[model samples]
Target: MADSAESAAVPIISTSTSTSIANVAASPAEDEAIPVQRKSSSPVTDPGTSPGQAAPINSAHEQSEQEDSDDDSALGAGSILSETTSLADEITQYRYEHNRRYHAYKDGEYWGPNDDKQNNQLDIAHHLYLLTLEGRLHLAPIGDNPQNVLDVGTGTGIWAIDFADQYPSAQVIGFDLSPIQPMWVAPNVRFEINDACDPDWGYKKNSFDFIHVRAMYGSVADWPAFYRQALAHLAPGGWFQQIEMSVVPTSDDGTVTEGSIFDMWGKISLEAGDKFGKDLRIHEQIKGYLDDAGFEEVVEKVYKWPIGPWDEDIHMKQIGLWNQLHWEEGIEGWSLALLTRVLGWSYTEVQAYLGKMRTGIRDRKVHAYHIINVVYGRKPIPS
Candidate 1:
């Protein structure tokens, strides 16, 4: 496994383009694989919305229904703030669909499932991230003694639990839409049920010493508001870190041909995110959001994460193998709701497409990889 010391020694390719591009750093032999960098400072627009097209105006009845849905959901900010325990029958009343279990509290809000299979996948992804960061849990410069830590969208509570174990003195709180985390946890760590998109997080302002958000690409509809909320709860001089991955895959060697299942998966997933109102391409806009949210000393790191065990670098090869399992276990859960609910695809259609996509993902010759973005910034202390 690669350590942080080794990772720091590797050179990183930097670019100012608005599109998702590979930032993989390689040795002299692999220089030919690097593409010419593009220069641009323009912001990326929502792929779901076209240029010059007016936003959809809902009718009075539709608007009322939407409002009602948000208010009645058990995971709504208002209800979550009032509820004492997440173990209520209503909170655990999971909805079943296509052999998977989803959170009933905020049904249809998040595309992923909360079942054991999906939870296992989430754990695998957690390990993959650790390896990608070279065994470092986070990139933020939050010193060795962070007091109050918040893990937003902490699926499986694995990351938070690990952090609590690492820093025994720190208090760690992990919140997610589902209460699927284990009851047995570290003394300083606890899990809660809440949605990050909620207007109020029910936490005091400027209380958290460190806030960590991971893999929240499609769960948030409003990026700017979400960042502001994260910023609000963070103490001045505290650090806020978010790690997100691009759904689109690219190959340094052109093995990922155009119009393939891999290609279609990326394109369709982006389309579904657009329809769902959450941008799947959040990795491309996180830096700007942090800057606009008033975070200071912001930093962004980009890495190319392989999908299979195809890379020559031993560390990357191991990470790729784990990533392959991630896609395999995660594809069904990731696809079912997004394709059927948002894109209007039938269950049968989604299954067939996933079959092909899974095969493509396992193809070692393809050398396909996704871009993982790690962005962190500090909330400036009062002047």
Candidate 2:
């Protein structure tokens, strides 16, 4: 793992006209930018590939095996048979609106959905993040053998499973409001259903060696309190890392004009988030929150994530292709609930607005991109 100072010293590509992306400073005046480093693009496989088939159940009794096979055949393809407890039924009792599914546990708290479509989009987003980070799972420098790791808002539990596989010694816990994670997972990893924004996390203090949060922009109402809770849960000298993308799209060349669909989408979404009490502009404020939470050695890295495959840079172009698919598939899930509930727009109205937004997302001429912010900090050890 790269040390904090070394990671900070490495320069990233800047989205602005300027050459380099900089580490955010304590104050705007103290900020410094570094030169951008261009990397050669590599081939990226499709993340949507189908998984291999599961092994057939083995039974000593032929009659038992025959019965099980009959039951499985009765359910048809793409179905599973499992005994469910009352609690399981309640957890899976998803609320449907505008043809999207929201979490039943914290029904209205989160803005996005937990349906199969949205889950696939989340996986695509996970792949985009991996590409953005040049195939690294995280940029926190958490070292080679972090003992206990926590993944907050672990949508599909993809990141947690991957991390557990990479570090077999680590005990990884991924918690979310929805119980959508697969039952089969790494031995060192487990999934829990919990509302992370709640005051009490139910975990003992100083429990985690590393805590990771990703794409939780509009989900967290109070970021300072969230950071404080993370700090409290992290062991001394442990790290807290967060990855968020700006909701607003920007262009270095001014191709994205004011009053355009892209611009309107951003303004209206941010407005809806404000009315909902969870600010969508968390990307711009996380660094300050980390510093305010008493974390030391705080570091921030920002990346330019293109919305479409319009970039001249080969690396960015590949990321843009995946990101374009992410936006295309995710717009409905991202917009429906927030706009209808908070902004008081009708379902039809939201759909109409999103229709135009989809066109804007696919317009390569716009050359729009969202800023991806990665901020991390370490809890200070006692003097």
Candidate 3:
């Protein structure tokens, strides 16, 4: 992993609007922009009427409304692009191997991509998480207005920002390896660069009211040790929740063939993660880890996340669409380092394999879904 101090101090670099396409939410009439490097566009200049000419009231009102709408639309896209640029700036000084641009941080450290594609995928996955959780930020029983919260592995810092917005009384800190969080965040929400696996988290003992971690599968080298550290830092009665997606896809109708590309992807991903001392399938063992770490009132909620718009339920179908898009957009970024660097496959071979896997992911007939596991536990109060 990158040095946490250096990552935090890096300046935010400027990026063009072209990179903002993946961040924007559009109406039916709007067009989606493709993700590509390009020069920043000039600001939209106002076409003011001539000095002597008075604009019509109706046209003026319409223009004002249009401008407001434009600003609103641009805010989300701007934040997303800004966060990506900041993260890129932080890690650009690091050594990257191969034409694939994979970071060579600690040997056998995080193998995930930190570029635009991965950032966009993080945003999309956040959307899907909201949808799956029925618009709830988390399933933890964090209680109302918890004073202090920490989001471990807070990619893109979207959850931390939203949580801060939801509970203004609480201070939310998003900790991550890369400085991928936006510069413009809520007063209560801030991003820090740190490794969760670091035994000495540098926080006061029993300080945090709540701690949240999500989509961190295959990131940490030690699961039990990490939970123990969380337990140590959490206040008595504080809550710790972990959310992870099972990398292995399952099918309800048995349409996903046993030896298909989906299975192959999961197998290869698991092997790669194991090689790095992090297992992508670690979600399966979270409950055990929490139990072993002496957490109390442990609870687990599992949700099936369909890969395509194949679900019979309307809500599930919409979720599947988002998941499908996220999977498709992320396949390349997710596979490149794992396949080429760790798994000893050529870049071309990895791309070819991902292409096949993506086809399976998009096939609605497959009815494929991954299990999303959410487990939370509380620190017992001292007797």
Which candidate tops lDDT? 1
Query: Which numbered prediction scores highest in TM-score against the true structure?
Result: 1
TM-scores for every predicted model: 0.79, 0.79, 0.76
lDDT of 3 by residue, 230-333 (tens): 99989999999998888888775677778987877778788888886788987778889999999999887767677876776655566667778778878887
Lowest lDDT 10-residue stretch of candidate 1: 31-40
Q: Give the poorly placed runs of model 1, Cα more than 4 Å off.
A: 1-87
Better of 1 and 3 by lDDT: 1
Q: What TM-score would you give candidate 1 relative to the actual structure?
A: 0.79
Best of the two (2, 3) by lDDT: 2
List model 2 lDDT by residue over 186-300, tens digit each.
Answer: 4567788788788977776787899999999899888889999999999999999999999998787788899999888889889999999999999989999999999998888
Question: What lDDT is reached at residue 93 by model 1?
Answer: 89
Give me the overall lDDT of model 2.
0.76
Query: Tens-digit lDDT track for model 1 on 175-207?
Result: 899998877664567788788999877676788
- The TM-score of predicted model 3 comes to 0.76
Please give the distance, in angstroms, between residue 218's alpha carbon in candidate 3 and its true position after superposition: 0.8
Instruction: Show pairs that collide, candidate 3.
Output: none
How many steric clashes between backbone atoms does each model show? 0, 0, 0
* Global CA lDDT computed for model 3: 0.71
Better of 1 and 2 by lDDT: 1
